[model samples]
Target: MIHSKRSDRNNISPQAGLLIWAIIFLVLATAVLNMPGYPSGLKPATFLKLPLEVPLTGLALLVLSGLAARLLAFFSTLAIGTVLFLRLADIGVQSAFQRRFNPYLDAKMIADGWNVLSGSIGTLTAASLIIATIAVFILVLLLLFTAQVRLADAKPPITGNLRLVFGSLAGVGLIFFTASQFDGMRQYASLQTPSYLTARLTLISKSMDDMRHFDQDLAARAEKTTDEYLFRGVAGRDIILIFIESYGRSAVEDSRYAPLIQPRLASVGDALTAKGFSAASGWTRSPTMGGLSWLAHGTFLSGLWVDNQARYDRLMISDWPSLNSMFRDSGWRTAAVMPAITMAWPEAEYYGYDQIFAAADLGYKGKTFNWVTMPDQYTLSAFDRLVRHPAAEADKPVMAEIALISSHAPWTPVPRLIDWLDVGNGEIFDRQAESGDPPGVVWADDQRIRRQYIQTIDYSLHTVGDYVAKFGDDAVFVVLGDHQPAPLVTGPDASRDVPIHIISRDRNLVRRFEAEGFSPGMIPAEDAANPPMDSMRGKLIRIFSQAQ
Candidate 1:
């Protein structure tokens, strides 16, 4: 009889055992539901408030039984898992693009990100990282599923008092959700998973509607005639539109970078002025901030806001003529020097290039600087030899778009400006490519990354300045930034405005740009009129053509 009494004292009843499992499930659910949407939002206080979904799911499980309860638990777990994954994606997209991820529009970024990752690191390492990320995601889903199943399989049913408690908790959750919508009560509100899901759904719906409107805008732009383009002012000059990667206003305005970058800009501007190259700089708001350079390129060329991948894709298929094509239509040879394009670029046809100098065609014998195929100086040299010099020799004016990528991410082993003659086939840059710290070491510290970024920008700017001073005798150079670097380097609140400099020996051309709101030096005015990038096409055509 004493042994039986001892056994009874130690053993828990079925209801008590299930109650313990339920509590464990509630804790796990609460943690998952309280996960913040941004990396900066992750703090100790983030988990202090309760999540509404936990109590609501518990109440549903309490009310159901058998297959109904099991099905509810399974779907609830799936929903929670999805929320967790999307929240993580949101943090990543916010860091890279300064915006939240849109499932409908941003799916292409996955493949692009993989390419950049494999290029920066090795393909094997990138693949392994992807596999590990997938494994962790799957493990998280499994844990959620197990907890949900345990909650559903509670034995001896919950008591009336517990049911009443769950119902009251669920009601409290609804009240918290309602409070979150009010300005005064929002600070006291708890995290609501349901609200997050609802917001994402709304965002998806809005994205679809936006794409439809974008298609209409593209159609409207495509209906214009080629007769509208007549670039007669300074008709004999070669126009080189050079895009300097990641060259944003922050390079000249941010306190950390300005001290180093502004001095270089002033020196370059002084040298250019002495060489009779008048320059006017201004700010233009790019469609994209951190990455996706093609969007800005398309917007600048097409006179349409190609802000997302969907818009860019649609713009490519439309009948609209790019700036290069407009120049091509008006009796000028057009070419593109794209060092970052390692593979086939069928889009060159759409841009109406008479010749294309891709990465492989550039004849670079040097080692690549991380993701940069070649240094900016080498790229400029190749353009001079392969396209610019040849066109000048033949006396055929050319409108060429040259992409200078030395300032791109993984900004290490920055190449110095060398004499144009020494940049033959790019062999001279091999040693410099191996000089500085690798990306792995540099990226470990934020300050180091910023310094490297500043160095690269300075290098690219000096390269352009020197190249133009030597080779730009009768040419016009419209040098601009593709976009800003990622938020990790520029901080989260950096502007989307990038600096654009029009450098030429023709003072009349510089004066025309000045009349259109550009300031008279390498540094743009602090309050310069920040026009949309898409407006560049119309501005150039109107300013240079007989229409002016």
Candidate 2:
């Protein structure tokens, strides 16, 4: 009786162990499916209907490897953890930009995003999320490793030709299922284990194919681009393109922010009028949202929809002519004033500018406020001193793109505009730089965040207005936002439209925008039809070159 009891207990033990392993596999798979940016229709319940091939195939590989099962498990854990981390990062990119993430291409630009991450580290919201993700990764790996060690010494659950046959069938079925779903299952069950991997793999392959055709596409577009002779309408005019960081349509048109920003908009209008500069405003769709200002900049300059990192990387390598290049080709000096750039930027070479002013070269000795490298006032002041000031004296026409970055993410410790003369190399603003609340404290409340974001936009507008008032007589100003603020401030599903204002002392330059559908002054008309950012290159060329 004791022997029979022992045999029965052994059988039960193997079954229970198999059951536990099955449960663990299911849990891990579900966790990946539920990550942010997952397909909306996918739920935990959907896993109940999924085929058993994925989990079964994993087990088959372990059982077939026999004594090496523990090693296989360790490697499997590493692979799954990496995929999960990628999914999490994609979720973050989607939430902010409303786009899918491509790790294969974006990984190359990790150095570029590092500066952005370092600047915003004080915001516990983003930092904590990253920390929690890494912690989870480590914990999951440890659990899997422990399970492998515990199971490695256990007696074989089953051993026979029958077992091998079952394992082979499971493996073959998994391969066939993944191949079949590679194209047809794009929308449904996309976040499921097999489907998710298949979909991402397909997209990755497509991106590669697109890159192969990128040069041909760019050359075709170049044929329609404005010629060098087209800039004559505005020849000898200093053209300055200013990109206001995170200044979106929501800041100007959303009811939550309009009350705070409208007054400043009105003031900007009054200030420009008082200075004898005519201004017209309208909207344009940005290629990116919340962040990734470079995409928007490239779109406007290259006349291509550089919506992803693959396209962006290609543009950096190609010999495509840009707005800057056009100016360069037309005997005008070109420069890029990028305050957020803290490291070497190879893209500057692609733009073909004569002068480049990054944060390090800007000569600012003030306290860094949150993510903003320097205050917008200081950035504009530096541009004046470095580029515009000398251009005025040398009698040279300059074309420059100045990125004003005070209103960047984690908007806090916003510096108010001071007397331009006192702004002297940005050191004088140290007194007010530490006056506002830190991002960690302010971001704790959503309403306060929204309010502060609006205030930041207001400050940027006033600073630009002040610039035009101080130096409007000799330049044509093209001011626009890079992208909308992150969804947190704009709420969900806000438009990607950003207000663009063209201010100039020449009445003809301002009136020319009217034919292309711009409003009279400072604020774009409520019902004006906004075009995409890529369309601006041709439109500007056509307008300024008299091609219209």
Candidate 3:
């Protein structure tokens, strides 16, 4: 009798085991369905609300059985995983670019992100991180799949009238969601996973519509007239258009940075004045902020708002003549010194450059400063050696676009200004690149990151100022910022306006820019003309091509 009683106590019914598994599945599904889409939404209140998708999924599982039930479970799990992944992507993109991710247009950003990651922290470590992330995502899918399958196999006793409860909850959720779409009921609405997915779908549809309109605009631009006398006013002088990476107005306006940067700008201006150079500064709004610099470049060169990858790609294939091509047409040798382009650039054909100096062609033999290929000083020195000082193109009058990347992200070990005569082959910067704490160590602290950003901007300013002071004999220098730094360095509400300065020895050339609302000194006034980046291509051609 005692043995039989012990056996009965130790063994439990299969129904009880199934009921326990059902409860586990419910908890897991609830947790996933309650996940937030943005970092700011990560609060206890976010999880306290229920997701309508959970109840609807549970109801479907209860109504179906056998193959039908398993198939429903599989697709539901996939949908949940997709929504979760998009939420995470949105969080990451918002942190870097101050915007949400658009899967329709931003798919290329994945490859771009990989390149930046590998460049920041060796290729091997980046590969390992990618593998680990994939592994974690697969593990999550498998767990969700297992829990769903077990719940679908539950019997009547285990389910215990759950179908009725799930149906009632789903019905109420649908009504509330529909009502929330109305103006009067919006205040009562709360964010849920299903609503987030619906919103994403709406965004995708809008992006597609925007692309169509953009294509129409591109067609209209291709039909515009091209001035025969473009760049005719500055025909004899060499034109150097320099784009300073991440050199936004915040460097000269933010309280955290202006104290250190304004004085440096003033000193650089004084030094240039002593060398008989005049500078005119003003603000211009960039189409993009915090990375994807090609967008800003395309906007400036194409004379159209190329804010997304789709627009940029379309502009490349369109009949629009780039600013470089326009200069080349007007009897000036065109060149591009892009140190950041380490791979094949088929788009260079569209830019119409007679000579292209990529990273490999610059002949830099120094250590890289994390992601930055070489210092601004080296880029400027190399440009002078290859394009300016060379006697081969002395009479041609060159127009070149040199990209200075020293102020780019992962700003560390900012290189100091060395004498131009001493900057031979860039070997002098190796020690400075290797001396400071690595990117990982510095980026861990927000204060350190801000400080480093300001320092690098100061270094870049000095490099450009000193280079022009030493090299501006008969050349016109157009220096501007590509875009603002990432949101991590600048606060979330920062503007997308960047400062542009035109420097030259000819006071007449300076007066032309001032006529377009540029200030007299290095600092742009708060009330100066703030044009959109796309307007510069047309405004510049019109300004410099006029009879003077």
Question: TM-score for every candidate vs. truth?
Answer: 0.92, 0.81, 0.90
Please write out the lDDT profile of model 1 over residues 198-217, one tens digit for every residue.
99989999989998998887
Write down the TM-score for model 1: 0.92
For model 2, residues 321-349, the per-residue Cα lDDT tens digits are: 88898888887899999998888888899
RMSD of each: 3.1, 6.0, 3.3
RMSD of candidate 3 to the truth, in angstroms, is 3.3
Better of 1 and 3 by TM-score: 1
Q: Any runs in candidate 1 off by more than 4 Å, and if so which?
A: 1-20, 120-128, 157-183, 186-191, 222-225, 546-548
lDDT of each: 0.84, 0.77, 0.84
Model 3 residue 253 distance off true place after TM-score fit, in angstroms:
1.6
**Which pairs of residues clash in candidate 1, taking residues 3 or more apart in a chain or in different chains?**
none
- Ranking the candidates on TM-score from highest down gives 1, 3, 2
Off by more than 4 A, model 3: 1-28, 121-125, 161-195, 223-228, 527-529
Global Cα lDDT for candidate 3:
0.84
Q: Which ranges in model 2 have alpha carbons more than 4 Å from their true place?
A: 1-23, 36-83, 123-132, 142-191, 219-228
Task: For residues 180-256, write the lDDT of model 3, one tens digit per residue.
Answer: 77877742223366667788889999989998998888777553334666677887889999999999989999999
